[model samples]
Target: MEPTRLVYEAWKRTEKIIQNTKDAKGNEIVREVEFYDPYDVKHMEKIDSRCFLCGETIQEGIATKHVFSDVFTDWNRSRYPIGTHVCPACSFTILTNPKNRTSLRNFSFVAEEKLHLPNRVEMRQFLVEPPEPPFLIVLAVSQKKHLAFKGTVSYNREIYTVMLEETEVIINRKEFTRLLAIVERFLFAFTKTEVQTGQYNQQRVLKFGIDRWEWFEEQVKPYRGTELLNVVMFVAQKVEREEDVLCFMGLGQKTKTPPQPHLSFMPSIEAETNDVDQADQICGDKLNDSQKQVQSEQIQLELF
Candidate 1:
């Protein structure tokens, strides 16, 4: 079935459960509401309007932002432009549930395939786990405006900037796969630190500590092109060799030479060097005895 039809059917199923429920004293609850039928011939003769979302003919009922404010109020304006009419099917699909609304924003559906509504398990997964790759993460404020909605992915010495527009989602799967792989490698190289929290004044409070993701993000900003892959690989290699990963990634180093620019799109070496001094102060002491021995041996080899 088409995505719209599938969504509409799913909404009907959910609506049936809600409408057919019994209240106290075995009373069948009934709601006074009008449901639209897009295929009905009599309804089709009423108006010749088109849906703003799927561009389908509005056979029966029409929906507007004012009518369905709950659905459209938090919608992305680029995806759902203002002053656009919604067809019955499109309106019902969006009004299915809050989960469906969230899925619509964060996921791209195949045009010919049926769109599946996100279940509770999938919703939980979105919070605790990272998506496989080539996925969309909608970053928007309360007004539903895009915020910093662009990122570059590097793979096999080639860089691809995945422009995340408010209207569409475009991604190069190969580049995204490579980018995620590098991120996994970078994460695996580090030792997992336990976060401690305590109950204070009827709320759970963080005692101390933060994830290394901020450091990763800072180090990665300067190398968005081909050098990004190399930098990640270098850090992974250092970790394997028992060398200090933070120092290699320019986090724990007091003084360092600026990296020479290789690509035309690469940021200025001097600008990238500016943040190193600040990072040096936050260097972690995670190196073990073996790591110290490895560093000493490397120094001796350099001297020889």
Candidate 2:
């Protein structure tokens, strides 16, 4: 097996190094993403030191940014003009230092137009808990609704949720109106079928809620006395589909078990069981057919 694997690796490396690695657009790749800086004197001294965060040190050279194409095309070595440079110290700092890790994670701001909607609106949605430290906090303002919402996303969970700060919207009348108009138009124009079916809807589910403006205060109090006039948005969920089965170890993976048959026993009759607890509460609220249709349409529009 080792011999066969070695032969395959040699053959593959020969082909890749010859055809793809040659004349790679190292510059273009460099242009697309930002690189970490190691030029600082303090960081430079830590060059041979162990990674501050992970504690592992690469022997080849100073640790630098690791870049890879998402689609896995030919390796464009030259594209990364500004390569990541890390010393043992930085590597360790990155993995172990909570403050440093948080700062690094917070730097992942979405570029403008990355979340553009059809009519030139840009979305500022985030995770309830981002998957990286220095959890993400976003403030969004919509011209149509003249609304601003603030929310935080964590960095550790697969599930992403949006949060609306209970803060007030401070935009002038026109912008606020425009923002609301966009939201309402989306609600009215979207069709129910769109929400009920398709991969896109499955990927981005909308979650909405309204509470006293105090909610915003509690959420943002840590950043005390910050301007509240600029934030306004609602919470939503970001969903992803996995192609393969996922395993959760130990915590007892959920498995289906057939229901056990009940054995009949002598009935216990305590004189009608105190009137069968007539006061037990049961929720019966539901949208009627037309209302359901409209709600579905609203979901579709928001999704779009």
Candidate 3:
């Protein structure tokens, strides 16, 4: 893939890192530094080689392991095999000139047949401008191990935040769309309000204070299965509107509830008989206890 203008600009801004070191005599000296030097011309030789990244033939190129040690880290041994070369241009792009270089551990890239966890500006360009579906961008949460990473996916040209578990990278479009619809419906149906106070009067003011991403994480991400549906259904039920429920469920049109069939004329005889039998059993027990109590009281009077 061709790098975007943003990537090129970022490359232009890159510069070599300089470091100070002490000599044997304890005199400090400044030197230009690089993780892997691309300009050490003593090792440069013309050989027919192919670049691993862009798949282009290179007349003057260096092995990927020499210059991409920091960028690919352990991936070089697995993803890009040995004897693979990278042209100077591609090396610059990958290394980003060292000053602003990024590693493969900061962002998660999920694509068909490949999954890479790393952050680079160039990678973001690809995600934002993908040719097809099933692409996701998850920013790694290096500080919090228990919390999920924040992810974004593009749908219909709109970006939505999604909470991703530590191991998750891909999400289906159907689920993404369903969640988007729920969030939109809730925001549309509810308008937040706050009370405002003045010297002489107090009034309530409407505010759009809730952020969609934060609300989703706090109120929706923790639930799953029937609980998730119930949460949304509860909100819809509170509004007490059929249209809201339909909209929250991603239904576009309102459906009329079918009228209940009349059952008054066709009552079940077995149910009626069971109810009568139960009632008779309860009354008979009560009567027997009352008669025994009265007999006991008469015998006590005769003894007296």
Candidate 4:
């Protein structure tokens, strides 16, 4: 499916749910949609980092006045910090519309992010614990409903899921393209086949819930736990384009000297000498979604 089409379908689904009034008090519940836009960017202490949204240097003045990032999460959470740097434009588009955001970290924030609808995994009963120490607690806010519409604030913690096999092959630029194409093709075919059978639903499939993840692994049990399945989950929705399959590792510069990697799951990140809004402890404090652009320096995941 085209990326735009898949994104639209997801939005349409959310729209239907939103049409009904909240607190109607029935079995049918519309899961709240969450986003990560912060207060006015002007008051924010700007970090000397690149904009995670467009990969451009965040110039002084208006270009990056609204920039923000989340705090470094517990080292036990994961090897990398839990956030990235986002530009103002991206902050507006992503925060303003539910149709323009995705749970996965692919695609540019300048563009509308694909929506990641809630599902059974999102239900409290099926939440899965991360395998390693650094508990990857992805924080989100329900700021989208406030865009052009009145709504209340809600906090949500989502798991950062890894769901593919990264070849880690040393390939030239041309080979890299071919590799992505092949990986995408196989996944598309597999998903199509599953959908044709009674095994998958387009809307609910591809979620990274613990039970779902284990079930997905069961299908290819032989490959489970092997080096073949090292890829991260791109989104909670079905496959659409190459962006969902590939990872944008890093897009910002260090505001301070890089901190050495810690042996404990909880690693220490050097904060900018002038400003630091987060801590290296439980990773409680947060900025916004755009600040999560710190993948390369904090995480060494084998990506596409």
**Could you tell me which residue pairs clash in candidate 1?**
none
Q: List the global CA lDDT of all models.
A: 0.33, 0.24, 0.34, 0.28
Model 4, span 213-286: residue lDDT tens = 33333333332233222221221123343232222101111223232121112212221312122221111122
How would you encode candidate 1's per-residue C-alpha lDDT over 1-304 as one tens digit per residue? 2235444554355432212334679786654233333433122234565655555555545546422555344344233354256665555434323332332333321111222223222322221222433232222223232221222221211222222223222323222322333243244334211110111221211211133344443334343444334322222222353124444444322344333222323332223333332332232234456654433322211110
- Over the stretch 137-213, how does candidate 3's per-residue lDDT look in tens digits? 44444522212112333342233232233433332222332333333344343421111011111221123233432
How do the predictions measure up, each by TM-score? 0.33, 0.20, 0.31, 0.24
lDDT of 2 by residue, 1-304 (tens): 1111222222233322111111254432111222233333243432344332223443422434331214423223222323344333232212222233222121213211121111111222222112243233333322211111122323322322222232322222222222222223222322323322211242223321122112222222232222221222232111111110011000111222121111112122222322112211110013445433322322221110
**TM-score attained by model 4:** 0.24
User: Residue 254 deviation, candidate 4, in Å?
Assistant: 58
Report the lDDT of model 2 for residue 157.
29
Off by over 4 Å in 1: 1-46, 52-55, 70-85, 96-112, 117-169, 189-304
2 or 3, greater by TM-score: 3
At residue 183, what lDDT does model 3 achieve?
39
Query: Over 4 Å off in model 3, which ranges?
Result: 1-46, 52-57, 70-72, 76-80, 88-93, 100-175, 183-304
